[model samples]
Target: MDTLVLRLQPGDDLRAALDAVLKTDGIGGAAFVVSGIGSLRGAGIRFAGAETATRIEGDLEILTLAGTLSPDGSHLHLSVSDAAGRVSGGHAAPGCVVRTTAEILVAVLPEWRFSREPDPQTGYAELVPRRRSSQTL
Candidate 1:
């Protein structure tokens, strides 16, 4: 398995950059181990319980980003700061825009491929182990 360390520069969209990497490497699935510790203009993050998105404005600092990446869909969560220096976190939605830059490190397991499937019980798409499921430890 190979690990990919990606550093996104200023003026780049965090999500978009990751997508580009996936396309370039022909990677349809993977996982992101995010550790953001920098200043940004601002960003939008949606919590799980919130029905509607709340606007968080001002200097933003990445607190944490934990989630998965797959062909089916991306289940990402983001945490950013507000003008009052309050921290906010939630599921990364469409409105999320990178302030200045975001650095992300992804563990690209070459031997294993990841994908997303809809679970009737959950009513949402989530990352799932692909072909390697048959292989036993």
Candidate 2:
């Protein structure tokens, strides 16, 4: 297991930075263990049990970020606040922009793999794991 520390500066796209890390590192599978305190210019998030997403265009502060990564796609959950500290969060999707800066700590998990596939019962994309041998020949 390894951890990649990221420091995003002003005018940088927050989500884009993380995605870039994954693409650059070729991290097909991993999980975010810790995120940092930072500010964003604009953000878009959707709550659970909802279809349409809402956009918040203002000074946004990332309070917390939790999620997993996989080859299929990265499953991310996030929460943020405005200048007043009013909080709103949900499944990490597209259109989440950054304002000032954001510092993040994304953990990389090796050997173990994560993926999202269709779930017949729930009709939602769920996380699934792949098994690998611990022993060497």
Candidate 3:
């Protein structure tokens, strides 16, 4: 396993940057953990069994960001706190703009490859892991 640390500059979209890294670096499998003070000009979050994400507006502090990242895609969740201490958390979608910066930590698994496949039980695509090479652990 290896770790990659990133600091996103102001005005950068958090998810966009992450996706770029996944594509550019060819990260087959990884876990993303992010936390920092920033603003989400507009954030998209999904609650409960909803099929789509709800848009949230305003400057917020990123309390938590955690999820799995793969070359196929990512499933990230984000929690942010507002000025009044109100906290909101859900699926981290695109369009989450950065205020000052976003610090992210990625744990890369070089020996594994991750992909999303359709799951009949849940009706949603889920992560599927496979060995990258035919080597014993």
List the candidates' TM-scores in order: 0.79, 0.85, 0.88
Minimum summed lDDT over a 10-residue window in model 1 is located at 128-137
Model 3, 2-39: lDDT tens digits are 77788898889888787776665555564555444456
Each model's lDDT:
0.64, 0.73, 0.77
Clashing pairs in 2: 40-99, 41-98, 41-99
Error of 1 at 18 (Å): 2.1
Top candidate by lDDT: 3
Give the TM-score (vs. native) of candidate 1: 0.79
lDDT per residue for candidate 1 within 1-137, as digits (tens), equals 45567666666666555555556555535655555444556565667877766666667887777676665556677887776778788876654566666777776654566777778988767667755554521
lDDT per residue for candidate 2 within 5-89, as digits (tens), equals 8778887766666656656655546455476667877777878998867888888888888777666676677889988889999
Higher-lDDT candidate among 2 and 3? Answer: 3
User: Comparing 2 and 3 by TM-score, which wins?
Assistant: 3
CA lDDT, candidate 1, residue 61: 80
Q: Give the candidate order by descending lDDT.
A: 3, 2, 1
**In model 2, where is the ten-residue run with the lowest total lDDT?**
24-33
lDDT of 1 at 5: 72
